[model samples]
Target: MDTQCGDLSAQSISNNYSTTAPPEPVHSTGAHRTEGDENAGGFGELTELPIEINERRPTCLCCGRPQKVCLCPFMPVRPLEVSTCLYIVQHPAEESRVLRTVPLLAACLPPEKCKVFVGRRFNEERNPELAAVCRDPKTLVLYPGSDAENLEDMKVDFSASVHNVLIIDGTWSQAKDMFHRNALFRLPKQVQLNSSISSQYVIRTQPTNTCLSTLECAAITLSIMEKNKAIEELLLRPLRALCSFQLQHGAQVHHSKEHLLRNGIYDKPMPTNKRKIKRMEQLVSNSTL
Candidate 1:
């Protein structure tokens, strides 16, 4: 696999992500996608927003909900049973968006167990850490296959061998590109997320029934590997939080108060004044409460 694109994945910082809260989910639903909405950027607007890089809430371009509270866990978890090391190769575009679970998994997962490789091409020599695993006699990069394990049975052969699963986090097309471009897969046994779900990206739409968000994949993989239940909670929390934040923020932006109309969007520039900031924070706290 080309290692250059894979290694340089973490090229940018998540937008407005000052808090440690689990990321909110994005990717609007396809069922509700009207022609007008599709024209608004076809879910890319929701998925590509760098909402997480900043501490403020990210309003979904579709439903205007916090990416976390979009209310649809469209992405499903694809658990795999493996006997080697696991790595996730993500497309950089996935990282550019704040509501992305791929970036959060990279940030939160234990470094010793899980590793993230990002970019269009992964340069083996450029990433010594990934190279060490790639060079390992038993490393594997996961690609969807007809022979892949069935996740619905929740059957992870319960092995003692250190198994690694590399999940490519991105849209179905982008994921396919990652698969074709990388040379890292030749290292070990391959795996893929159980393809039984319709995807949980609430603000984006995917054509495949097998697609899953990055967090769901990671949560299932961890459950299979270490049998930790908290991973599920931790992984899904961000999505909800993001959804909730966006809803609140969007409401503020659309507030019918005289101040907005008089000032106009971007003209008066809503005061970032301390009092207003405090009011917004209080509102957020009260809503969550």
Candidate 2:
């Protein structure tokens, strides 16, 4: 399905929300450099050519995931078409992660529905499309703040229009910096999901029970807004499978910061400087989940 700006509506979506969707082809591009032929004086020049890595050892073909931790079988066979469109503003550093869930989420949705913009700050010059979407009145940014309203507790009715969900993909500190530096993010109304479910990414530690991975947050928010229980349950299958694979491969289970603190098992982290203390405080206090 091709997505056009201001063309999405909940009434157009099928109530069953289940249908066959053809797999979208994933493309990879890169360039390789090699030494050119030696000249008469035994001097050589560099040459560049378009190259595609056909080696099957590092990456799996079925899913774009690394061969070491493939979770294709656990993922849904087709994309779930919903009323809400997910706009992810991902940190540049997150793309290199071996087990990140954004790729899985992207693979599960239509290419146009799950748009990602990778950068630290966005403007009309650098990212005009994103800036325009952020300016939409129906768009809502999922950031927690004292003045922000709870997503589940919103007093207004949303059955009449489309919703654009903007999520920042990064760790606690990176997300904070992204949120502060980006003026476009401040234009939308702020909302948050207050969920009791803990994160399924056990290999990585989270600062609070309210904390969830980008995938987890997206799933929960969509399920609640669309009022479809199956969305959250089915969308999280890859996360469970990935965590299981890691655990079997000798990865230690990590407990959430809130759990460890409440049980008196977490050590009191001592900050060496005032800057470190502020960052730590922000992490501990962050509850955007």
Candidate 3:
């Protein structure tokens, strides 16, 4: 229930960003001069040499964003103290994404509370720490399936012991592949959020309306495990600010695929495979109920 992160004024937030784009490199025509040109007393023929410019934007070490769009101001001033630990199994691709949410999730929690392991494969010998956590009785994996237990229905005694929660960070397909390929992931009890809340990550499209971002999943799980409902809101404040900033800077709000299909605005081509088509139809049917 701790909410100590202070807020910044709109004017102050806007002051950090520059409206203009980076200046383009200017080309110049000049005689090429080698290292020893002056000693040789001769210059190469006139040639147009493009001035090399370091175009890489200055990045903020804390949030891993360009200085202009850094989310540090919105982030919790200090990491939240929590008993439950989060183990994020992130796909390799997620590291390269400019707008990924895993960094945001890590920023909100204490360093020891949030640990990220990046890879598609994991084994006992190679990943001893992760393997050990997977074998722990209190460990639970956040994955949705017919066999998965709803996290809300589970009985947990927070005062007696802390829990380690594992979350997969990737696209739906990537996450599914990781779960099936890694046997260690299946060692822990699988749990899913049974909330009806829609995702607030407006900059990225989700497979379904019920689908939440990696950060959102972690926020909800942490709140439930810590027995602190306010933790969810505290974790989400930065995310909401990020999305709002993106929308103001020409980013469009992305609707979920399910929402697009239901509203008859889905522009993508239908699958040619009959089974795929049937599955899509079933999804559309279920959305109505």
Candidate 4:
């Protein structure tokens, strides 16, 4: 994916939106020395390598910062009443990757109110409350238009406003699996999102036209239900994070001319040969994954 710029180096897409990411940690000189000897161990698999360091710091995929320093004020430390509580169900496999935005949404919505669960089996993580919500009889799910009831004809107690939306978070395939495997039919109202905006995830591909990243879909659906007023800013924050991550990772795979900063590709500053040897040796000795 690298676009050649004289020489090749991984350019991170994160920098594009990292202005909002948390600040880097400040480690003392003594901390580095103490952690050195123990760090030198085994290295073999490419997947095992710590890609999150040097090129990839432990930045929040959503906020683009170390988890400890999440500065996004919207990250819902508490449930700020925006008329809805997102039931964000995630596929466990996705937790390892940075693609999903539901976890990041925790920063915007009430951490406790915005629940997350993952697994092959649903009963494996059973909760009376979750079951109640979907089955609440009063609750409504937004599935595809064909099988779903019309949104316009939807009738709710408008005195408070219709707030419940079951957001299934993942790739299209993953979402479908949640629908079938989990007996989403039991849900109050089935929702099928008809979205115009194409997805923005660059690392992975998905079905076109009818697809959207969870964040984009969330915002669109919320905007429509709220009459395009409530919680718009909160929804947009996660959307921006996704764009930034794409830019960061895209650059990492393909170094742009302007972003070339001589990271420790070579151990020493001047000579290329000796530094190359040392870097290789260090890479070999370091414990991966």
TM-score-wise, the better of 1 and 3 is 3
Question: What's the TM-score of each model vs. the native?
Answer: 0.50, 0.74, 0.80, 0.56
User: What is the lDDT, from 0 to 100, of the residue 112 in candidate 3?
Assistant: 93
* TM-score leaderboard ranking: 3, 2, 4, 1
On residues 256-281, what C-alpha lDDT tens digit does candidate 3 reach at each position?
Answer: 77788889999999899997687678
Point to the candidate with the largest lDDT: 3
List ranges where model 4 is wrong by over 4 Å. 1-64, 67-80, 150-162, 200-204, 248-289
lDDT of 4 by residue, 130-151 (tens): 6767766656565454567655
Residue runs of model 1 more than 4 Å from their true location after superposition: 1-86, 151-159, 247-289
lDDT of each: 0.51, 0.72, 0.79, 0.50
Which tens-of-lDDT digit does each residue in 1-289 have in candidate 2?
Answer: 0000000011222233223333333334664333331231122111122233343346576666566777778778888888788999988877665667787778777777789888888998889999989999999998877867889898755656788989888877788888889999989999987676767777777776557888888888888888888999878998788778779978898787767756678787666999866655654665333
The better-scoring model by lDDT among 1 and 2 is 2
- List, residue by residue over 1-289, the lDDT tens digit for candidate 1: 1111101112345554333333333466665655764565635445554464434565454333355554324322432222334477777776565555554444444455556677778766777777677676545455556645544343545465575566677765577676667776556556655545444444433333234566666666666556666666666665545444555656222221222333353244555889755544543343210
Worst 10 residues of 3 by lDDT: 1-10
Q: Candidate 4, TM-score vs. the true structure? A: 0.56
Q: Return the lDDT, model 3, position 151.
A: 94
- For model 2 the local lDDT of residue 81 reads 80
Question: What lDDT would candidate 3 get against the real structure?
Answer: 0.79
